[model samples]
Each structure stands twice: as structure tokens, then as C-alpha cells.
Target: MTETTAPAVGHQHDGPHGYASDKGAYLKRMRRIEGQVRGIARMIDEDVYCIDILTQVSAVTKALQAVSIGLVEDHLGHCVVDAARASEAEGAAKVKEAADAIGRLVRS
Candidate 1:
């Protein structure tokens, strides 16, 4: 893998919404995670060893968490920031609400 960094928000890397933008990297990550999930399902059907299946299950969990964190970052960098800049009254509240939701997800 190339040494990498996420380009600054709303720069050339930003897509239509200027926030929640995909540098295409995010989609690719999700696709890989999806494949991993399918593989896990197959392992179950094929009666794979419990330890091996659990290892892959762990990988799937981490991949999903990574995806969620990426979206949260994009939301903050683009959507939340834009709303704040435009002086939307509920902007911060929305971000807080989202953060709380994610917190619950993480705790689960």
C-alpha cells in the first residue's frame, strides 16, 4: 500500500456534497469488508474451526469500526463544519446527536 493521507476536506478530494465525500477509498474499504463478511458466512456453513472463524469475525468487527470512524470524520469535516459556518442553529446539536449515537454503537 502506498503511504497515504486523507486529503483536506472540500479540496479537490471532496465530492458533490463537499462533506460525506468519498475519495473512493472509503467505498473500496467497505467492499473489502463486505467480502470478509461473506467469507465469514461461508466459514460457518463449511463448519470451520471455532478459533479460525472467531479470528475472521474479529477482523470484520475492526473493519466495520474503521468504516464508521471514517464516516464520522467526514461528517465532522464537511457536514458539521458547513452547518456551523452557515450558522445553522441545530448544527452542533446534530453533530452531538450523531456522536452520541456512535457512542452507543461503540458500546454495544
Candidate 2:
């Protein structure tokens, strides 16, 4: 799998992001996921059964996927729509970027 990195310094978005309105909720969900991950580590450390560990892993994966899908929808609704209103070229660019992101998600 490809490894993604943070945006380059000083290259951050100029305006509020697509998920800006729901940022708090997103962070909450992420924290929950983090806890789940820590739980998984504890399970391994405690010699939990293989199946049970796998089950927890699957749950964590699904939670992450849900977050991803929500972000995608937000991007399409807010960023893509706003770009479309700004200009055809900008809209097309954002669409392509979003498509690439979706492709990565699907492959994952």
C-alpha cells in the first residue's frame, strides 16, 4: 500500500475545509478509534484468542471506513460544489482529486 504524507508546510488550504462544520464530531470519532486501537494492542499483550483479536480489528477497520465515507461525502457536497460554482476548470480539478481519493479508499 502507498503511504500518504501531510501537506507540505505553508501549503495548507486557504479556507475552511469540507469537514469544518463537523470537525468536532470527526475528532471524537477518531479518538474513539484510537482507543479501540489501544485496546487491540492490550488484547495482543494479554494473549487474547486469535479470533477475538481479529474481530476487534475488523470492527476498527469498519469504523475507519465509515469515517472515510463521511469525509468523502462532505468533500463532494461542500468542496466540489463550491468549486463547481467558482469555475468549470476548478470543479473538474476537484472532481479528479476526489476521484483519486476514492480510488485509493476502494483499493484499501
Candidate 3:
């Protein structure tokens, strides 16, 4: 099945089978970011202006962060919630794991 038909990784919401509704948007964002990354690479290869390259780098970084936030939100809304509904231990594990991942992201 395609992205649309696939069940949301962590949810059973009314939003197009979980993240399915968001999938299109996510892919579009990713593609835009991907192109930005390629442009940065090209700029570096061509020795483009330093400030211009830096600006592109910053944009790429922000785009990536946005994607990360979206995934984290989805995971919490769907996966963590499901685990919490399952059992306290599972919920605890999920929360701890998410926290650790967030910590890592923040440090990076």
C-alpha cells in the first residue's frame, strides 16, 4: 500500500488514517528541503558567496527541525498515547525513550 493507505505509525485518528493526511505535506516539505540541500552543495562546489551559503544552510537546518518536530508530535500523539493506554510500564518506557531522544536532539 502507498503512504495514504498505510496506517499511521502511532495513531488511529480521524485524520486520513493517522499521518496519512499529513504524509503529502510531509513529503512536499522533505522534497523542498532536499532541493535546498542540493543547492547548498552546488553552491559550495561553485564557491558561491559565503553569506549566501550560510543562509541556505540555515534554511535547511530549520526545515529539518520542522520535520523533526512534526514526527515527534505524531509519535507522542499516536504511539505514546497508545502505549499509555496499554500499560503503565509501556507508557513509562515510551516516555523515557522520547525524552532521551529529545535530549539528544536538543544537544545536537
Candidate 4:
């Protein structure tokens, strides 16, 4: 059997799936990272030093990792915990999903 997932719609301003309270903070950090990306592109265009560009790239990677960690923590603390309270099977499924997500992040 094949299972399909539908893309989430109209959630930009509704906050993250897990972290509803810190939506503004997350958005601000993401915007800052977006600017950093633009700056890195400009640096490349202007023939900036390779090391400098690599350093910026590393910073962006770290920032994204931080965001990922935060989201995962929120998911486990809220979603997974809630599911655990509701049912053992559901809780196990949520835990497995969280583990898979963490594995992907680690591989990346």
C-alpha cells in the first residue's frame, strides 16, 4: 500500500508545527540567515576570498542546525509527549518518527 502526504498550507503566520510560542523569534533568525545567504552570494560575485566564503557557509550550516535542534526538541516535548499520554502505539510511532528525523539531520 502507498501512503501519500499533503503539503501543509497557510501556515506561514500560524507558527511552526511544534513551536507555537516562539514563532517570531524563529522567523527573525531565519530572516537573518536569509540575509547571510544573500551576502555570501554577493561575496562570491565580487570574487571574495574562498576561505571567507567557506566560513560564512559554515556559519549558515550551524545556524540551520540550531534551528533544527530547537524544532525537534519542541516536537518531542509537546507532540510526542502528548501522544504518549494518549496511547502507547501512537507514542511509539511519534518517537520513531522523531528518531528518523534526527538521523537525517545527523547524516546531513
Candidate 5:
């Protein structure tokens, strides 16, 4: 299945994103998760136990969720805050965008 991502916020700040400082760490975690996913595929090809594959799937899911949460936090701490400081309307729009993202996470 294909994955869909949220669109970028309309705020036009030229500075680095909130996650910039932690970009390396994020990349590392994602790479590890990518390895886990590959392992899962290998397991399936080898006909591993269903529960074992499911366990890996769960781990991958949690890893992705952790990343998602971190990104959301960064966005709030930086993007939303900056927008809020810029103007009330910009802040409200950011807040709504964040709420929509959170809602998608919760539903998923």
C-alpha cells in the first residue's frame, strides 16, 4: 500500500526546522527501522512463524509512531510557536494543522 504524508505548513520561515538539530538522530532511528523492515521481508520469504513476523511488524509500527510523535513535538515547539509569534491567524492555522495531524495519527 502507498503512504500519504501531510502537506507542508504555509509559514515561510527561512530558518532551520525544529528537527534540524536532531536530524542525525532521527535519521539513525529511521535507518534502524528500515533494517527491521527488511528483516521482516526476509522472514516472510523464509516462511517464519506468523507470530514472529507479527512481532516485528509491531516493532516497526511503534518505531514509526515514535518518529511521528517526535516530529509533531518538534513542529509544535518550533513551527507552531514561530507562527504564533508572527500572528494570531498564523498560529491558529498551525494549531488546526497540528490537530489534523494528531487526529490522523490517532485514527491510524
Candidate 6:
């Protein structure tokens, strides 16, 4: 993969409503994750060894965690920052929402 960094909040990388610049990329990643999940289901249907199935499950979990981290980073760099620029109250709300999301992710 090419090495590139995310653009700052006010930069061109900001998409509509402060979403990530590469929304399509996120969708692609999710689709791949969905495929992995389907593969795991197939393994179970085929009566694969328990350990092998668990390994695939672990891979899927890690992929999902990576996606979650990327989304949270995008939210903080884009959405939360935009809200802060708009108004302090809006920013506070965004921060709380983000914290709640992180909390849920952690509990998961």
C-alpha cells in the first residue's frame, strides 16, 4: 500500500458533512469483511475443525476492529473537529457521542 496520511479537518480530504474523503474505501473494506464472515459460515457448514474455525473467526474480529479504529479516527479528525469550529455546544455533543461509541466498541 502507498504511504499517505490523512488530511487535516479543513483540508480537501474532508467530504460531505465532514465524512472521510474516501467513503468508498470504507465501503470496500466492509464488503471484504462481509465476505470473510460468509466464509466462516461456510466453514462451519462443512464441519471444519473447531480450531480452524476459531482462527478464521479471530481474523474476522481483527479486521472489524481495524475498521472501527479507522472510522473513529475519521470521526474525530473530521466530524468532531467541524462541530467544534461550528459551536462549543455542538462540539461537546459530538465528543460525548464519540465517547459513547468508543465505549460500545470497547465493551464489544
Instruction: Mark the regions of model 5 whose C-alpha exceeds 4 Å error after superposition.
Output: 1-12
The residue ranges of model 3 lying beyond 4 angstroms of the native Cα positions read 1-20
Give candidate 6 regions above 4 Å deviation. Answer: 1-19
Position 17, candidate 4: lDDT: 62
For model 4, what is the C-alpha lDDT against the true structure? Answer: 0.82
For candidate 1, the lDDT comes to 0.72
- Report the lDDT tens digits of candidate 2 across residue range 1-108: 332553422323446778999999999999999999999999999999999999999999999999999999998998789878978977888888899999999999
Give all candidates' CA lDDT scores: 0.72, 0.88, 0.79, 0.82, 0.89, 0.82
Model 5 scores worst on lDDT over the 10 consecutive residues at 1-10
**Where does candidate 4 stray beyond 4 Å?**
1-16
What's the TM-score of every candidate structure?
0.73, 0.88, 0.79, 0.84, 0.87, 0.81
User: What is the per-residue lDDT of model 3 for residues 1-108, given as tens digits with 9 covering 90 to 100?
Assistant: 355553435523333333555898999999999899999999999999999999999989988998888888887887778778978977887789889888987877
lDDT of 5 by residue, 1-108 (tens): 332443433644556788999999999999999999999999999999999999999999999999999999999999889989988988898899889999999999
- The C-alpha stretches of model 1 lying farther than 4 A from their native spots are 1-20
Residue 28 error, candidate 4, Å: 0.6
What total of clashing residue pairs does each candidate reach?
0, 0, 0, 0, 0, 0
Residue 22, candidate 3: C-alpha displacement in angstroms:
1.6
lDDT of 4 at 13: 17
What lDDT does candidate 5 reach at residue 87?
A: 88
